[model samples]
Target: MSGDNPVDRPNGDDDNERPEQSKGGDENNPFAAMFGGASTEQFAQMLQGFAQAMSSPSSGPVNWDLAKQTARQTVSAAGDSSVLDRDKRELADAIRLADHWLDDVSSLPAGCSKVEAWSKAEWVEATLPTWSRLCDPVVARMAEGMAAAIPEEMRQSAGPLLGMVRQMGGVMFGSQVGQAVGGLAGEVLGASDIGLPLASPGTAALLPANVRAFGGGLGLSEDDVRLYLALREAAHQRLFVHAPWLPARLLGAVEEYAKGIDVDTSRLESLVGQLDLTNPEALQNALSEGLFDGDEIANTPAQQAALRRLETLLALVEGWVDTVVTAATDGRMPSALSLAEAVRRRRATGGPAERTLATLVGLELRPRRMREAADLWKRLTDARGVEGRDALWAHPDLLPDADDLENPEPFITGASELAEFSDLSQLGWDTSDPPVEGTPDDNAPEANGPDSPGNDDAGPADGESPDGPDGPDGGEPGTDRP
Candidate 1:
């Protein structure tokens, strides 16, 4: 006992004993230099620290608390101003009005149940849950892959500490997510700006400060910008609300991609070899440097297919939102065209935060063929009218594919399967029934303004919004959101 503790060394090996390194050399044993040549003392100290960290392992795959905290801090540093009551009222009014106008151009009815103006920090909070859902699969897989990549000899050498590496992975992934989300908070105007439902199914939220920032260089009035963005938000909500299959389909694609993530054993080995675990911040920094960055991840065919599905879905969403918003705002808002062009440019170029998010997810959400998708939607609208175009969203199968984005005439005309349907009801779309209350009805007298009854003036009916506390799309018509 006074000499050296046998318990500290693996299998009570002598002090001079060394683990056999892989034939490829020390590079293969990433933890060799990482742990000072894998010394017993270093292992003991790291284990002590990991034990302390493990005491509170409630954070599942990602340390969501750290993510939220870091995101709030980043937004605060970037000057996140709390949204005022007036800001909320203005946005609520804009959303109501935008929804009213959308009725004429789109088949989906009023989708937003809860409308609020969010600060950048608030946006981060509201959207983090969805981000968690989207990121957890990939993050968990990455952790598993990395842990499995540990050399067999190193595994026996590191003992239980190797299993705890996943905890470190969580922290690192959380850090990256926090930074990426915080960045996106500054860039996104609403939960749906990136063409995915980042908030609750029926929740319509917008960052007013970001909206103003977006419209700044465009020389458009702040009100006009807000209304235009509001139209986009409402348009997105319509689909999110009416098309129950959408969120799952869109999110499922990401999960599918995650399932196909081909973790490079060599890369993980190299990464382990190079990581400076002495500094926790170094681990976080390394994640930002692209743990899954280009060429590092070899995309499998399944992954490519998932990406294509995701891309097509995203493009369809963006294109539909653009078409609906343009139709709703044109002639009504003098700056509609200008605003549309600005949005197109913003999406095409992307922002710093968008790029950061892309890096974190290993996927760029640029709807690469958004314009083409929009044209296809417009073509469908021309061929079958708004109801027909919207009907396609009733089922994922009905939506155009990547090929259709190129030459949509066949799909628009009678070449596709949709032509077989005499009416949308055959495809599950019920056109005969009148739209439910809160939904826009063409035959009904139009509300004079946003303040009119049944619009923003009335509060949630019976203490619940259409898609409120009961459930998403609870009171709405169509298949309930799953």
Candidate 2:
């Protein structure tokens, strides 16, 4: 049997449910007079107030039924949401190999994440909690904006419906998100390709068929593709599991930016009024098309810094994964180069899951900072060695910011001991000439002091620099990291 509380409309749902669908003088329909009479903004205002009231210590977002219904529909549309038993065993085997291979190259702990091969639908089910947490803050702010505009009269008469709409909106968006993500289930190579640990930390999961399908576009064989993807996935899991604060930091930055989003009610009113109940995609198109438009929602002063931090962090993750995976498969995989290129292109263009996330919450997960971050990590590893580079993850303060990603040399070299190695050749990476011995390393080239949270600390610390892991002598708040 179908879920009892299914959403009344799966498409864009803005229609009122009354027998007389005419745009006449029907007192029952608040929207009936919307054609030429009084403004419907008043009704919008009431709904907004209702949303706020319900949200005050609010327990839930949307009605759960809408989410489930939409998810089921999306799964049905994909026609391959179920994970095959054989694929799961294959994924586990691949991840096991990945774990062993990674142990030989990096100082990261062994076997932190459990490996699971998930069906597309299963992936959708498992990842929703994280998605909700990431997106709720922005949705709350939007709801707040809507609530603040409600009229006193509307609150006294039909305020209940206001709350209903907010709930409806939540489910509507969730359904849209589920459908979008479902479309992507057959596309993603692994859980972390989107840059965040979209899977449970210490657990490696892949969709075998999906992985094969992704490889189909390129001319690469399935075995080589799976091995390459497994390396990346395992590398990602290593970082997230070992770095305790990263997941929270990444999620927090997103929420902070979302909180500052300023929505224009006039536009929302027009959007809500014209919303078609049977066309969810059309509603999405309207928002992106500037129908229910507001001013641009980019970084604020606070947002600018936060966004930069997030971008840098995200970039570092990709960089680290890229370096580690490339090294792990060195001479081992024939299609490594081709696979790397394909992954980069995939990220740049973005998959359906990422696009769906953008629509659900205003955040885009394509990793615009990836190249810079990768360069920064490669530079640091070259200066300090892998252990030294990985040590930065022990504490947030030690991590590099966008600026540090720009210079890289100073941050990594500041704590690196050249005397410890046989020279630059032992470091193994070849980016540029080594910095002058005894020369001061400056991450912020022209600046005299460190940046915020010492976020730009990417240059490997010269063995002599005081910036190395502070042994109880550090001045920074998060300096005790590692």
Q: lDDT of all predictions, in order shown?
A: 0.64, 0.55
Q: What is the lDDT, from 0 to 100, of the residue 227 in candidate 1?
A: 89
lDDT tens digits by residue: candidate 2, 108-135: 6653436777776777666655655654
- Model 1, span 1-482: residue lDDT tens: 01211112223212213333221113223211221232343234433444434555535677666667667766887788888899999999998899899988987767777887999988887777777767777776777777777788988898877656767655444554665577568778888887777877667889988888889999988989998889988888788767765775677566666777766666677767667767654553443333343554435655655566666677788889988887887778999999887876655454432343343344554434677788888888888878778888876656777667766676677655555666656776533433444666432222211112222243434434454322441211112222
| Best prediction by TM-score | 1
Scored by lDDT, model 1 comes in at 0.64
TM-score of each: 0.75, 0.70
Clashing pairs in 1: 30-273
Q: How many clashes in each candidate?
A: 1, 39
Q: How far is candidate 2 from the true structure (C-alpha RMSD, Å)?
A: 15.2
